[model samples]
Target chain A: MRQLSEQEFALIHARLKSLNIRYIEVYEEIFDHYCTTLENVPALDSQTTIAKLNETFACSVVKNMDKELEKSVSKQVWIAQLEFLKFWKHGVKGILIGLVGFFALAISILLIPASELILVFLVLIFCTTGGIYFMKRDAMNFSFQHKSVSVSSIAVIKRVGLLNSLMCWIWIMPIVLSGGNILSNNFFAIGMAVATILSIIYSISLIAVASRLPKSTLL
Target chain B: MSNNNLIKGSLQTIILKLLEENEKMYGYEITQRVKELTAGEIKITEGALYPALHKLEAEGLLSTEIQQVDNRVRKYYSLTKDGQKQVTSKMSELQGFVENLQRILTPDLKPGFNI
Candidate 1:
């Protein structure tokens, strides 16, 4: 076999990294599996028997790495396939969400009372649209599973956002449905509407911040 | 090699040389072959063996095929044309080094140990 150029080895190293493989392990595999004969002993000056024994222990990892390199797939295709799976998963989720939302909206329109019908219809529409928009945007972001993330922060922020968005929709839409009855004695409705808007904005901001936080910093 | 450092340095050469001769080999098969030839002196771990193999395949010095064998999938690796040339050059360099070392350490061998 030929000696590898530094550049060539580096390239191979990079590919291995992408595959999430450890380099030392590769060397060990190779040494253990292929380079065993006395004739194949590495060119090194030491106690003949000990050299072989030490090499078995030393190249233990290095040879394994080589053996792995002998067996694994190229880094490029592996990453491509992973990315494809992620994209497909995102697409499936979006479709399922849309279908379920649509079905609920249809059922509500047919069964609900006239006085409450239009308001419910509009709320459902707003939620479906907002969710679809967010889903599409998320798909474009393309986060890798291997990439780090802050789970606690993300969860907190997401919870806040969900609450806020929910409040925003439930509170404001009733008034708009009532054709903007500003002077009405609907005090509870007015307060709920105000709280909802505030919560929605808060949630949106929380999510924005959450997305920017580095994975390493995540709790 | 004397120790880990030397093995690390020459690992690629060894892999390239083996592939040059055999054309292709699988992970387990390569491991077994090395053990057999060395008489169980060199031991390779599965952990380290896989990554390096992957890296070479990525560099285009080697190519691969994944085939199902006995209900399990196995990935096979083979050297490219450039890899073949590389193996030749490395082997010659290693041969020269060994010869030089022999002369330096055994200066009297030419006449005194000729028998």
Candidate 2:
């Protein structure tokens, strides 16, 4: 079989990129496959081979490649989700310990005057928003680090971040809308507990998805 | 290539069985190997080949490793532990299916069946 020259490989790579196969892993495989097939077709030069390859793949090229990319990206996301679940499972003891310590602190805070409780609630809101903002910025930075990742894969990461933000909203909206009525009422502890739990879940998900982005770098 | 419909359902199994024998293979090598083995009767289209490979990898039945060869990267796929186990079961299932198919097509091949 004839070995492809550097220029030939570059041309093939460019063509695949033009077809939106931005993922390096997929791009390399398709490049090799095209080269090998062209090699088997004796006497065909690089230009003709490329044209033939394009013609051969023209029918379902983009559709099939996109579908494959989507499958692979979603699988990566699914694996990250599973890892996040595993992290939660193994971190259960630590979570329980934290919860116990938190409840003790909450009880002590509750014993304070209502004015102090309002101040604590305000601080909690500020901290939660800050945490969410930083987590999102970190995820976006991670996505940015991978230059050759497909648009679809980046979209997956964005969707996950959006979901985390939405979850944060769901946790915080009621507390804000009630104008601290819930905080003053008996449900203050329950509301805070729910918010804390949701924040923890969101953080785990963010970390998992962000961890996957770094692996998306081109080979 | 000739009987795409027939080959479609068993593509993954064929790939698994091939990897089971060959240890590891790249995408084009698998296609050529299939063609050669079948004497060019069964041509695995590139379109079908990649999606199957990705799906198998996603299902934990295959794993990939990339190696730089002659100034280019080649992605080679091999069966994982789960994939190894799956191959045995899948091959047996396919064997059973083929036997059933043969019996139906050639009813006389069965002891009590009559055409």
Candidate 3:
């Protein structure tokens, strides 16, 4: 078999990129297929080999790539949704534990002076901010690990990121804006509890999806 | 070459069976193997082969591993545990289909019947 030169491989890679095979995984697979098919051709020039490949592959490479991307993206979305469901299952368990803790704390608050509630509220604010910080940091770390992620995978990541940000804004912003007085309100406390649980779940799902992305190199 | 419609439904089965026998194969290798085995009578197009492989991978019936080979990366696919189990059922289904096709094509060959 005639091996391709570095220049020849570079040309093929450029051609594939030009053809808009943007996904790293798809590009690698197609590039390998082209190389294998063109390996032992009589004339081993890049243009000729590419032309022959196009002819043999019926000139529908781009269309096929688009189809593959569509299928891949849909599959990723489906898997992410399944992961989200799993996260929700665990979130519910965590919420049950939190509920038990909340009742115990409430009983303790009855015995303590009302002035100590402010200290308790301050601690809640500090923990919420720390949780959001860690969530963002973990997500950033996960994204950094895979440098060449596909558009579909990026879309999934972006979706989770958006939800995480929105949850933080919806849940955290009001408390910050009210200068911690919102904690005194029963409705605000209940809403914050629900939002915090949801934020944790979203953050976990985001990290899970990010980790599931194929490695940046070959893929 | 067979009509695409005729080959489409059985593509996954053919792929699974090939993986079962070969243990592992790359995309082009699988296509070339099919062509060689069928003596060029069956041509698996690039457009069809890849999507089928990806679909099977997404379905968890096949798993892939990448290797750097002679300056380029090659992605090899093999049957997962589920895929191994799937091969038997898929092959038998194809077998039944072929038998039914034969019966339709040659009604005289139906059991106990003579032309």
Candidate 4:
């Protein structure tokens, strides 16, 4: 078996970038497949493997189908994310953890001064977003793959930001509009507390789900 | 024997059964194994294979891991506990389908009746 030189590998990488592959996840897998097939299948032994990879991934009308592959992969990612929402559906451990989590959150909310609670929420959200960014940064190497958003992580951050917007609209808008301390008001304070607790739980679940995504996470 | 639709319909079962035995396999390895086992009668197409894999993964029957092999990273798929259970049911379902197809194709063959 002839080992391809670094130049040949670089050529293959460049060709893959031109294949209209949309997702980083798909691109990475195909890159490996292409390289492996080319490396393993000797021209004298089996040129068919190389032909197959080239025909489908690099050099033919397989472009349409490759797009479909990317779409299917994208769909798979979305489905996996949705499934993470049901973390407690199948097991007692998850429910127990959730129970423990909510209890801890309730205690924290109750003990912390209501006036300072808004700062707590801000800090929690900030930490969650920043943590996810760092995790994604390690997984993605932008110099290798030509892509946007690294791993759809930016889109997820946008979704997280959207949640923050909704929370601000619900909890902070009234205070700003009416020029009053909505935090001191019992109705809004209790409402915000419940909302904040639920948000924390949601963020925890989101982070938990995001954490599980390895290099396969794509946009 | 080279029926694309038949193989397509059974691809998930084939994949799950393979993972059940091997415990873990990558996409290209799965194709090579199928070819080796069938003596080249069944060649899974590149177009069909990845999408099917993605679909099965989306269904939560398979999970993937990435390891750096040489210069590139390979994504290996292994059956989840749910996937292991599915292998049994999918294999049984495929057997039932083949049996019914046999009955239709050979309706004249009857037991204990010599004509």
Candidate 5:
């Protein structure tokens, strides 16, 4: 197979970039596939090959496939977070860390007045979201350059930060609607307590997960 | 791929079996191999190929590595240990299914039912 010229590769890259793929890992694979397929076509000019390829591999088709890649990558990160939360087998160190997190979170929940619970949840969300941003700072840098994010970066933000924030709302929603009387509901309270402990552990695991990501994601 | 529905269920098996033979392949290479092996009778669309590859990777049956190749990065996939084991079971499963279908398609291949 002939090597695609820089101009040819750029044309394909710009087109793939236009598709606005979420993950860099997905983008690179698709870019190679498009280039390889185009190169195999008999004797068409690069521009014509590109046009033919673009027409065939429509943006929607690639986008939908990227969505699947997004889902699959997210699933592993989510599972890994839970796996890291396994206090016994995964590590005794994580057990100590999880316990520390749980104790701190439980105390905060116990001491924070009912009226301020919503504010606390909001702060918690902001912190988790902000933490991912600061922790995965390289993803931000890479995204600006290439218009795509590494799998682990997006996974940490979407699966851990965003979903965990939504999980927080479950605890605060009823409290706000029922004029704080829901605070006395033992069942709801216990459920929230369990969720709180899990979230705390999961959040700690997020640190472990984020740090585990490849530091030098390809440019 | 004319028989997309027929190919759909067997895509994973095909991928696993190919990797078992070749040891490693990138996405496009896998597609071309399938085309060559079947003489263009079977085609794996990129749309179907990628998600299937990603799903297999997610399931621990495949693993990927990224390398700079031909002026661009290419991601290569190969069987994990679990993936190697899966190939044996999946190959047997696909073969069993194919054999049964063969019996159904060509009744002379098997003893006739006398209900």
Candidate 6:
């Protein structure tokens, strides 16, 4: 067996470090074993030792696959998803601003003559757009290249969120129905109550989920 | 050894023996050598191997060096002066264990077995 050259040795050393295997004993043991094996093969010498060592290290049983480790990693991903929802909920400042806009519309609903409900309608449109924008942007960094959320995590959250949101909507249906038709006097009152209750519940749950996650530094 | 065989307590002995012959080595190589020598009889995963290596290094018996390769890096390991002495001490301890086992097993060679 050919002995490992200085360069080859350096390369091997570098590779091992990358794997986070940083012990002097491990290095020496491997070298000794490689040399000992090489010595047994009369046709090979020190020059071939590295080649043998490389092959052996590449195929070593030390790099065994571990299912437990994989499971832990996936669990972490799940937690991160939960945290993202929390993060989104924590964007309460934005939500509050949107509510301010809604409040302004409320004043208009009461003070302005019923002939100009168009102003209230326009205000509602703008508030919804602004709330959605801030929720998307401030909740998580969603740039295409630097996207942090995992697809699995997003899928899981969306599934849960959809179910939860649907429940909230169901609870708010009475308010929506009580709003009555656009031509009715109870429209604004019922619309405001339904919107307020749903927003509060959604905000509280999202923030609570984000805050309750176990603190981990793996990321 | 069989899969059911337990080599937990003997890992240090095995490590010492390997280092006694070679001047230095690294984590990946040591694991590889054990597998090759044992012909797959024993396998050490990265998870188990790293902690052991870190513990042994912490005990002041091992030192490390970082070297850069073409596209990656690796760490090489070597024994300190104290580590060398440790090898001999560990070897004798292992020898004692084997001798005791032999004495217990080969009772026919004892003074009363033939009688």
Please tell me which predicted candidate would have the highest TM-score against the true structure: 5
The residue-level lDDT of candidate 1 at A81 comes to: 34
Per-residue C-alpha lDDT of model 3 across residues B1-73, encoded as one tens digit per residue: 7687788899999999999999899999988899999999998877888888888988889988988877678
What's model 3's overall lDDT?
Answer: 0.69
List the candidates ranked by TM-score, beginning with the highest: 5, 2, 3, 4, 1, 6
Which parts of model 5 are misplaced by more than 4 Å?
Answer: A38-48, A103-129, A137-146, A161-168, A178-194, A215-218, B111-115
What are the RMSD figures for all models against the true structure? 17.9, 5.2, 6.8, 5.8, 4.3, 14.8
Local error of candidate 3 at residue B4 (angstroms) = 1.9
Which candidate leads the pack in lDDT? 5
Candidate no. 4 TM-score: 0.69
Say which prediction, candidate 2 or candidate 5, comes out ahead on DockQ: 5
Worst lDDT window (10 residues) for model 5 chain A? A138-147
Question: Chain A in model 4: its TM-score?
Answer: 0.62
Query: Which regions of candidate 6 are displaced past 4 Å?
Result: A1-219, B109-115
Better of 2 and 6 by lDDT: 2
Sort order, lDDT high to low: 5, 4, 3, 2, 6, 1
For candidate 2, list the clashing residue pairs, or say none: none
Q: Tell me model 2's lDDT, rounded to 2 decimals.
A: 0.69
Docking category for candidate 4? acceptable
Which parts of model 2 are misplaced by more than 4 Å?
A: A39-45, A87-156, A168-189, A205-214, B111-115
In model 3, the Cα lDDT at residue A156 comes to: 55
Write model 6 residue lDDT over B1-115, tens digit each, in one string: 6542356666776776777777777666777788889898887544455445555655667766655533334556678888888988888787777666666888545543321
How do the residues A167-207 of candidate 1 rate in per-residue lDDT, one tens digit apiece? 55665666577775632434543454345344433433344
Number of backbone-clashing residue pairs for each candidate, in the order shown: 57, 0, 1, 0, 0, 26
- Candidate 5: chain B TM-score equals 0.91
